[model samples]
Target: MDSERDELLHTFVAEAHEILDEIERALLQLETGRDVYDVLQRVFRATHTLKGSAGSVGLGGLSDLGHAAEDVIEALCRGDLPLTTPVVSLLLETVDAARRLVAEVERGQVERSTSHQEVIARLQEARRGGPAEPQGAWATSARRATEDDAEGATSIKSIRVAVEKLDRMADLIGELTLGRNRIVRTLRAVRGEAGAALRDEMEEQDRLCRELEEAVRAARMVPVGPWFRHYERTVRDLAHAHGRLARLVVVHGDVEVDTAVVERFRDALTHLLRNAICHGIEAPEARRAAGKDPCGTITLHAAHERGGIALRISDDGAGMRRERIAARVRALGRHPAPDALPDHELFGLVFEPGFSTATESSHLAGRGMGMDVVRRRVESIQGTIRIESREGHGTSLLIQLPLTLATIEGLSVGIGDERYVIPLRAVLACCDLPRGSLAHGGAQGLMVRRGRALPCVRLRALFGLGGSPPPDERVVIVALDGFEAGLVVDSLDGEGRTVVKPLGQLFRRVPGISGSTILGDGSVAMILDVDALLGGVVRDAVPADALDERRSAPSAAGGSPG
Candidate 1:
């Protein structure tokens, strides 16, 4: 009995935290120029549900806070209280206190503290200042709407699965995917020697295995909407605190991505938003002087790309100045003026540890820590980040992430005796590298395909494998972070679903290689990090005109990416 009760308490804690996040998001929406009455209903239901759940679990402090919040929301909906900034601020603070209470419960510290009482008092003060509650036809309809909202929330069905269990399932599926690849390779090798019926059966089994692997990955996919919504309160509170009037607009909220990616990106996104408020968006008076709207806009957009999702956070305010950033770069003892460097490399300076241009430190940005952490977390998931800025215009940050981390569609290529896998999303095209195309003493070469010049890299020399280019070497074009390069390889080994396995600490620092994977032939293949490889070896060698042509070209093979 004790065990069962403990399980219930754990479940309640998780659910309560989720409910609190929803409440905070809804409260933030109230500050937007939308129909405040409608948002009040959502806040009311969320608070009421939280109240009931807390009471059921014997969390008296949380229940009391929720009850007070619910009363304030009801008064606002009934027109007894005005939806002023202070009311919204008070309610938001209450949500934060509730979140802390939930965290304490998770930590096995359930007793309420002084903060809970403080929140309850504020809630009461907000409600007491309101006029007498209305009781007429309007009250009747409001009551009915509230009841319907409560019913809808209660009727929604959900089940909780521990995140650790999900991770384990993903790991198991990864191993199974690897096994499936091995079976497919074995069957292909024996296809000519085996009987017709036997080959047919084997083919069917291969198809089923592929389907199962996809199903497993699909099961772990989650919409990024809830995570985006949770940031609404953060943006609202931070903007007000910084005296920068800003609005957070989210688009394509229904776009789905790997749950792991969403979880990993939460803190990075928070830091980015905070940075935007602190350094990107200017004060209201400054904006008006600059002939811009007084209220700045920060928009987050998520959408499907070729083989992954692209999340863009753009702000319409004072953009980053290249010269100023260059000055900071010099302070850090780095060479090449910021204007001399490409936009990608220049903006990436913000992600350097201990890189900041702020004159003073504050609760938000400064101390030069956020962007570097963002970059680390992003790369940890095998994702890429890029920034775009125009002075006095705006700044946009784009993060491209794969669908899932467990398995990826990869193309295998051979160079001499070793094999390598390049993610299909990064592989643009395959073309022949004609003989005697050497330039710059073979350090870097340009491949002219169909009147378009593409900067190319020789893999053999890059890895120091001590082998000359073969007569029939093929160049595999890969596109990453708006740059395109042709990778010289011996031959193509076709495409396969490559299951990713993490490398040890020793290999983790190795550049150009992301992780290792087992091939169908039981051989180990290195997974190429196309972005890192291109960033390291080709970005500087590639001319600006060639890359401009690459971007102008329509096909991904030309390195033009959405």
Candidate 2:
């Protein structure tokens, strides 16, 4: 009985948080003066349901507070109160309070941690004394029938599965994939009639496994829209606090991605967006002086691209200045003349450790911002991030991420005796580069491909594998974002469908390797981190993760194929 009751509380907490997200979004919408009547109604229904749900679960304090907040919204709906900035702000604050209460519930605590007396008292006062405003469309919409808010009714085609259960299922599928690989490998040796029959049966089984893998991946996916919508409040508050008018425009966020990926990037994107608001945006007077709109704009866009997801965050504010960056670089005593590096590489320096243009620190952001952390997170998921900035125009960051981290389509290649999987999407073309044609002293080497010189690195030399290379070396030309590079290997071993698995602690810290995958022959191969591989070639010069060694650089493989 206690187990069932605990489960109910968990469900309630989850539902409450989602409702609070909706309420917070509605409050932001209210601030914009759009569909006041309908917005209030939706929030009213949500709040009423929350109050009733809390009461049913014996959280009286939360229920009472919700009642007070409900009274104020009800007043606004009836034209007894106005839909002004104060009301919306107060309601948003109330939403925060409710979030805290729900958190306590999530912690398996029946006892409330907060009375929220101050917020509740102010809400009641607003309900009683706030002056009525012109009815407008509110009065007419208020007359329309709305079902009792206390009732929780829903029609949905879904089942609630614990996240752990889903993860376990995914793990099992991964194991099954490994087994399938082993069996398929064995079948390749057979050549008689019985072997042909076994091959046909194996094909059927492979089809089933692919379908199951896709189903599981689909189950783990969540739409990026709701997650993206939550940031509207963040942008609004940040802009207001800084005394600027900034709008967050989210486009095509309806694209779905792995739920884990969504949660992982939450803080990374927040740090990026916060920087956009605080530092990237220009104040109203300055904007007018620059002959631009007083209100700056921030755009968050997501879409499917190149067999993966591409997310771009851009701002119409004073873009980064190359001169200022160069000056800062010189001040830091960097050996490279800033002019020697290309514009892209120069802009990337801003992500280096302790790199910031802010003159002072604030409670929100300053000194040691998480741009490096952001890059690590992106690269950890086998994704790539690139920065684009224009003087006095704007700056944009584009990030590319694979759809599901559990599996990958990769080109299996050989360096000496070792096999490494280069992400298939990263591959542009594969060709031969003779060993005698290259001259190199440092780790950085250059190769001419398609009549253009591009940075090239030898895998065996880079990873320190002990073996003599083939005279005719092959190069898998890959691109991440706009930067292109070449990885020289002994041979191209064709394409593969590999299931990603974690590596031990030793390999996890390795810079160039991302994760490991088991081949049909049961030999483990390292998955190369194309972005990290380019880290040296790109000449981060000073990496943001140089000091701390980003723990989130994903997994690494140990021991080469014998």
The TM-score obtained by model 1 is: 0.79
Badly placed stretches (over 4 Å) of model 1 are 1-19, 45-49, 52-58, 74-82, 102-115, 125-199, 288-293, 326-355, 438-455, 466-469, 481-483, 537-562
Model 2, position 318: C-alpha lDDT score: 93
Q: What lDDT does candidate 2 reach at residue 314?
A: 98
Candidate 2 regions exceeding 4 Å error are: 1-15, 52-59, 77-82, 106-108, 128-171, 181-197, 284-295, 335-343, 391-393, 438-447, 480-483, 537-562
Residue range 345-426, candidate 1, lDDT tens digits: 8988888999999999865567898899888888777788889999899899999888877778899999889999989888
Worst lDDT 10-window in candidate 1 = 150-159
- Give TM per candidate: 0.79, 0.80
Q: Tell me the deviation in Å of residue 37 in model 2.
A: 3.9
Model 2 C-alpha lDDT per residue in residues 430-506, reported as the tens digit of each score: 87774444543223366554445556667777778856776677878776655566777889888867777778898
Candidate 2 local accuracy as lDDT? Answer: 0.74
Model 1 / residue 260 / CA error / Å: 2.4
